[model samples]
Target: MAKKVWVERNKDGSWDAFGDDGAHIKFGHGQGLFDPGDLMKLALAGCAALSSQVAVESTLGEGKGATISVDGTYDDELKGFASFKEQIELDASSAGLHNEDVEKFKERVQKHIERSCMVMHTYEHATPVSEEITVKQ
Candidate 1:
């Protein structure tokens, strides 16, 4: 399924993004909202965290607790992201899983998340983006 959003510039030089579900997100340098770079980092982190959570739950059953921390390095010279990292911490004792099982689960989850996360795959594979602009008089 394809999703779409509409964005328009506000009078104050900020921008508003509108989704089909009526959600609104404001963006600008001074709009007190998330800027483009911030949003990009957020998207990446959120995707990784969510994917890791799913992996952990599937491996250890539901109610298992885990924490995922995601970080990305922005390259100012290249004007893009340089690298990304994710740390997944699982509560194996609470889940009552053995050390060997936890290790295996962690390894499997890591591999699956690296391949399954859309945002992470895009970042790693360097997806191409193109834009065209038109002026109406």
Candidate 2:
């Protein structure tokens, strides 16, 4: 894997971060397209998506046998701290899987991906956070 890198901000309430693909993600006293909490949700959803893909391929097989997609949303009241609603959804199709099997996939996602998502775990456990930002100028 590539090096894990991050850009940060000073404690006055600011942040600086960039995506590996060269996308800028920043925050300052409440700015930017995303925040810590939002990122966590995204991470959980992303993990679920990837894990589901892996699970589907392993369980069902590959080569035009099945197609899988996932969408996720989380409830703010459930997650707490984060007011924005997060919901996760899944869209899948398979030539070999019946409706029952699809349901099984959902179960697997609920049991494995949703349950094991790193961010989801963090949110469920309520982890502590330490933040600091220092200005360059």
Candidate 3:
């Protein structure tokens, strides 16, 4: 299935993005709003956490969760993010994962995210974007 989303500028000059599920996010150049770069980082972190959820829960117990953070520096010259770093903090001791087991679990989680996280995959491999312009007379 194809999903469609759009961003519209409000009369107050702020922008709101709408998704197919009726969720809206306030975005613009101001406080309490997310810019495009901020949304990108959020998406990356969310994707990583979701894609690795199965592996994490299976080994770390169902209730155990993790914190995933993504950071990147915006480059004015390039007008885009230079690079992104993703960090995941997980406590394995609760699940009794020792040195070897912990190492294996780390590998498993990495594999799961790398294999299934579409956002990370897009970052790794460049996806082409094309734009079409329309003029109202």
Candidate 4:
């Protein structure tokens, strides 16, 4: 079973997310920069990194440890208050992963991320936001 995840939105329009007793993550909400909404693409990249490992381990059988790192590019033009395009670059070791196998992993990770990446799915379809304001006269 996966660990529980929780997030608390902050005053600067950022959100802090915590997972299982691990380090907390702060997501920013900037227009031209990385924002809370942008987490979708990053989530795709991140999940792909781990999923690639899963696919690798399952295929190659257990041996030494392996890892994958992913980075993404989000088109600023299309990235409005809503939609955007996501591109991911994956890096891995050559021992357990051949060039063709790595390519396969990339494609597999992309497909799986589309189905399971929460942030992407949420933003791509529906976004629910609520604002609380206190005024002084």
Candidate 5:
């Protein structure tokens, strides 16, 4: 499947991004919308969180009381993200998982997320982006 988004520059120097699902986001200072970098961070964190949650639910039979936190730094020199870290916490006792089971579950979940997260995979293996400009007469 393929997804597409449209971004249009407004006259006031702001921009609006329209998704295929009728969702839109405004971008610019004072626009009350997320900037591009913020959106990237959100995507990375959200992917990790969702993947971890699913893994937890499937492995532990429930996902209650599980929390995932992700943080990273954008490197201008490298033109990419750096120092990405994700922390996942779960109350395995409530889910009836023993200590060994908890540790095994955490390891397996982390591995699955690292392998399955699309954003993380893209960040690791960045693809080249190219643009072509067209002028309307």
Candidate 6:
């Protein structure tokens, strides 16, 4: 099944993105609205959290959560992101993982995220995007 997503301009001169699943997010220029670049960063972070969930919970016990933070540098001349960094924070001490166990757990989660995060994979592989515009009379 194919999911549909679209952006529509608002009466107030802002824009919003909507998904066929009823997801909505405010975009474009405005306070409290996420620009496209912001969304891209968020997507990477969100993907990391999800892809690493199993490894984290398996090591830290169920219901234990992790925070994934993403930062990137944009290259104005290249019109693209120059670099990206992601940090995953979890309380291994609270989970009783010490010494080698903590190190192994971190490695496992990192490997899992690197392999399974589609968003990150796409970004790393430089997926191409094509635009199609429709005009109505």
- RMSD value for candidate 6: 1.3
lDDT of 2 by residue, 62-117 (tens): 63122323233556677645332345454454436778987887687567666566
- List candidate 2 segments past 4 Å from native: 1-4, 8-32, 59-86, 94-96, 131-137
Give me the overall lDDT of model 6. Answer: 0.88
Give the better candidate number (2 or 3) by TM-score: 3
Tens-digit per-residue lDDT, 9-113, candidate 4: 888777788888696877766654456545655665556545445554555456522343334455668665534555544435544687798777667756766
User: What shift in Å separates residue 83 of candidate 4 from its native position after superposition?
Assistant: 3.6
lDDT of each: 0.77, 0.59, 0.89, 0.60, 0.76, 0.88
Rank candidates, TM-score, best first: 6, 3, 1, 5, 2, 4
Which lDDT tens digits does candidate 1 get at residues 1-137?
A: 66679899989898999988888888878757888877777777777666677677786678664676667788999988788666767766656777798788888777767877798778778677899999999
lDDT of 6 at 52: 90
Q: What is the TM-score of each candidate against the true structure?
A: 0.76, 0.53, 0.89, 0.45, 0.73, 0.92
Please report how far candidate 3 places residue 120 from its true position, in Å. Answer: 1.2
lDDT ranking, best first: 3, 6, 1, 5, 4, 2
Q: Number of the top candidate by TM-score? A: 6
Write model 5 residue lDDT over 53-97, tens digit each, in one string.
777777667635356666678799988676677676775665677
Q: Which pairs of residues collide in model 1?
A: none
lDDT of 6 by residue, 11-121 (tens): 988898899999988888779888788888999999999999999888888987788788899999989898888888988767766688878988999998989999998
Over the stretch 27-121, how does candidate 3's per-residue lDDT look in tens digits?
98788888888889999999999999999999988977679988998899988998999999887876876789988999999999999999988
Model 1 error, position 95 (Å): 0.9
The clash tally of candidate 2 reads 14
For candidate 1, what is the TM-score? 0.76
Q: What is the TM-score (0 to 1) of candidate 3?
A: 0.89
